[model samples]
Target: MRPADHDELNRLCKGVKKSFVHLETRDSYGTEVELPHMATWRRGEPDDFAWLGWWLEMLRGHRAAGRTCRRARVVSEPVSDYQRWTMSHVGLFTDAGEDIRYVARPRLATVPLPGSGDFYVFDDELVLFLHYTGNGTNLSFEITEDDRTVRTCREAFESVWALAAPLHAYRSE
Candidate 1:
């Protein structure tokens, strides 16, 4: 299937009935919406983080509905500047009911991961593989309902999750 746009992806996420699992393997992402904020952080300026309100509300709603939302980030030691900036505000996501974890890249040497870059598995049935440019710009999402693909992604994410530390406990050293 062809790649879908962000609005369509968000719609699919909102329709998730049980769980949402996101696996991020990139150390840096150059998203248009986030770059400006990241720059402000780099400058040591204060950000109220009001821009995250919508996403936070979505997470709160998902939690209220008894749905699970989790993200696992596989990062390198001495994480990239982008990761450092992201970690600084990760508390907001956790507080809003998203479970975010981090796994050091070295720990995954023997682990099997999907050949794709990053992906989101919805309710263990549907998978949305994210495509990105070399510079970390998000391109599009390729979705699939193939059972084998779903199972592989779910297992891979679970394996990674098992080795990850909750953001609060991870020191990133």
Candidate 2:
């Protein structure tokens, strides 16, 4: 079946019991929602962070309800302008209750990772793989209830997660 839209990808997170984990491997992200602000950031100009944005608000609510939400981004060294921009907001994400970490791609030479796309594993049951267009545009996603997919992704994510530096220690970005 076709995966859900990005907006619908997180319903499982809310339904999760233990944790909702995200793995991001892209150097950049493209979405109409944040394009303007991202452009302003690249220009080195002040931009609105829109703390009340839906994503952050949702995270806050999840946290308030005692659910743990976390994300790990595998990025390249000397981070791209987009990654750098995202790094600047690490605090915002964490403050909203996400435990964001950064993993250097080069360091994962021997590590097995999710191929092609990123995935979010909810309570170790649902696995949603996110796909993107060549231009970094958000495209689509595929979710699987397959035990093998979920188990393998959770293992890969955990392995990378173990080596990832907490946002505060991840100064390269």
Candidate 3:
């Protein structure tokens, strides 16, 4: 299925029975939707979280359904402006029940990652591979449920999650 639209993610969240895990392996996301906030954060704005209510609400609804929503990000140290900006918003999602964390690039020096970049695993079964161009526009998505694909992504996420530091700790250091 083409998960190009936002509703598809909502549907997937609704269908998730056990858990939903998202692995984001990028230092910067050049998607236009996030550029404005990234720029704001780069300029040292005190309100980097003015735009995350909707996402938090969605996560709250997902958690209300008795499902777990977790996200782990893989990033290089001295994180990019975009990543720092993104992290500022992680608090919102976490408050709404998504377990969020970050794994420094060096920590996974010998470990391998699944797929090319980011992906969302729903119920640890349906894997939605998020494909992005060099510019990070989130251009395409490939969804699959093949046992190997699901298992690989699931394992990859678990490993990263284990090594990742929670948002508060990462920001404090």
Candidate 4:
């Protein structure tokens, strides 16, 4: 694929800004913690420090918010290794609100798409993909009408939710 022109890239970024920012990451913990920071950055004017400060402030603000927030939920297939680690980190910064719902399933048939990391997004919803590839993650996104991808993600989550078991229901502490 040919490299995108600078101006074209800028225009594309602007379009993304109008839509929602999509962030797919292997660092699940960092990305989750970075949400509020990203929100702060977006609310600030475009200065060199704007982005940096936004993330830093978001991290700080999230800690201050409480150990749980009324607005967050943990939906996953309950991978014994990764998801647990990711959610623990998420819990630490979720204090401002106290309504975190942990949704988990024992297994969901993996969806293979010839990639790594699956997908991670911070648009209208924060999406994390579980089955993608070997090591790294894949962060592919396509902008469709009125956030069709967001709906697609929500649907995917719901499907998994239907098949998943509650964490406490299945496993003993």
Candidate 5:
């Protein structure tokens, strides 16, 4: 099922009961809400990061409710400018109770991933695939509850997560 809008996606994510695991394979994302901040970063300007309040609050709520949220990012070594910038601010997410990790692309050569894009598995039962354009603009969200697909994505996320390092300890070497 395709989420009708961003709000629908947020509702689905908010409804996750036990766990929310995400696998992000993109080097950069051109999200409208983030682009301006990224530009400011590129210019060496300071940002208050107030825009992340909503997301951090949600993570806090999930944590308070005993729900676990994890994210594993597969990135190329010598990360892109976007990834570098993102990593710099990852503390906000971590501090808010999200477990975010990173794995170099080379480390996944021997691993089998379910698909070629990004996805989120909620409660290990629903899979939300994120479709993006070549330039890293999000296109749509497709959700599925098919057991096989969910299992494959969950396993793939775990495989990558196992090889990942916490963002604070990650080095691009």
Candidate 6:
């Protein structure tokens, strides 16, 4: 990496500090998003447009902030080629210095599609409402002075992250 590249990388990691909040469920990837909040339950299938669009927006936002975001999905079953493809697209952005991240950590956490999760970026007071449900899933959120929930959520994310496998670990067909 060049000098600028190194600086950018530093900035990216800086976004994830001790205060980032994250919410994931038992069916982390399968939970249905309520279109209203970022919590998960149980679900049938993944919403293609919603999932894809969320990835796109997240990548753009992270890129805008000069940082990278890594995702680890622990599913009950193996992911399909199509699912892998969607994930790969996010990975491509990381190649462009956008810091894209994805992983398949089976059985770690589960959240139904259309559920909600929040991530609070500590340094900048950025709280991301992550809703993975509905036709046009929205991660509607607000920044608040209360950091308790955010802190807990971030800890949860780290717990899952610790157990998650790297994207390269899985060989997609």
Models 1 onward score TM values of 0.97, 0.90, 0.87, 0.35, 0.95, 0.46
Error of 4 at 128 (Å): 10
Q: Any runs in candidate 3 off by more than 4 Å, and if so which?
A: 1-6, 45-51, 171-173
Could you give candidate 2's per-residue lDDT for residues 5-67 as a string of tens digits?
A: 755675776577878889999898887867788788778898667744767887888898888
lDDT of 3 at 9: 62
lDDT of 5 by residue, 1-173 (tens): 54545786788778888989999999999999999999999999999999989899999999999999999999996899999999989999999999999999999999999765799898988888888899999988888899999999998999999999997677734
Predicted candidate 3 versus true structure: per-residue lDDT over 15-73, tens digit per residue: 77778999999888777767877777778776646466676777788788788988898
User: How many collisions per candidate?
Assistant: 0, 0, 0, 15, 0, 29
Quantify all predictions' global Cα lDDT against the true fold: 0.92, 0.82, 0.80, 0.36, 0.89, 0.42
lDDT-better candidate, 4 vs 6: 6
Question: Which runs in model 6 stand beyond 4 Å of their true positions?
Answer: 1-68, 74-76, 80-82, 98-106, 109-115, 118-124, 132-136, 142-145
| Highest lDDT model number | 1
Measured by TM-score, the strongest candidate is: 1
Better of 5 and 6 by lDDT: 5
What does candidate 3 score on TM? 0.87
**What is candidate 1's lDDT per residue for 1-173, written digit by digit as tens?**
56778997888777889989999999999999999999999999999999999889989999999999999999997899999999999999999999999999999999999889699999998899999999999987898989999999999999999999987678844
**Counting only residues 3 or more apart in sequence or on different chains, how many pairs clash (N, Cα, C under 3 Å) in candidate 1?**
0
Candidate 3 achieves a global lDDT of 0.80
Model 2 CA deviation exceeding 4 Å by range: none
Q: Judge candidate 6 against the unseen true structure and give its global Cα lDDT, from 0 to 1.
A: 0.42
**Root-mean-square deviation (CA) per prediction:** 1.1, 2.0, 2.3, 11.0, 1.4, 11.5
Give the residue spans of candidate 4 off by over 4 A: 1-80, 96-133, 138-142, 146-149, 161-173
Give the worst 10-residue stretch by lDDT in candidate 1. 164-173
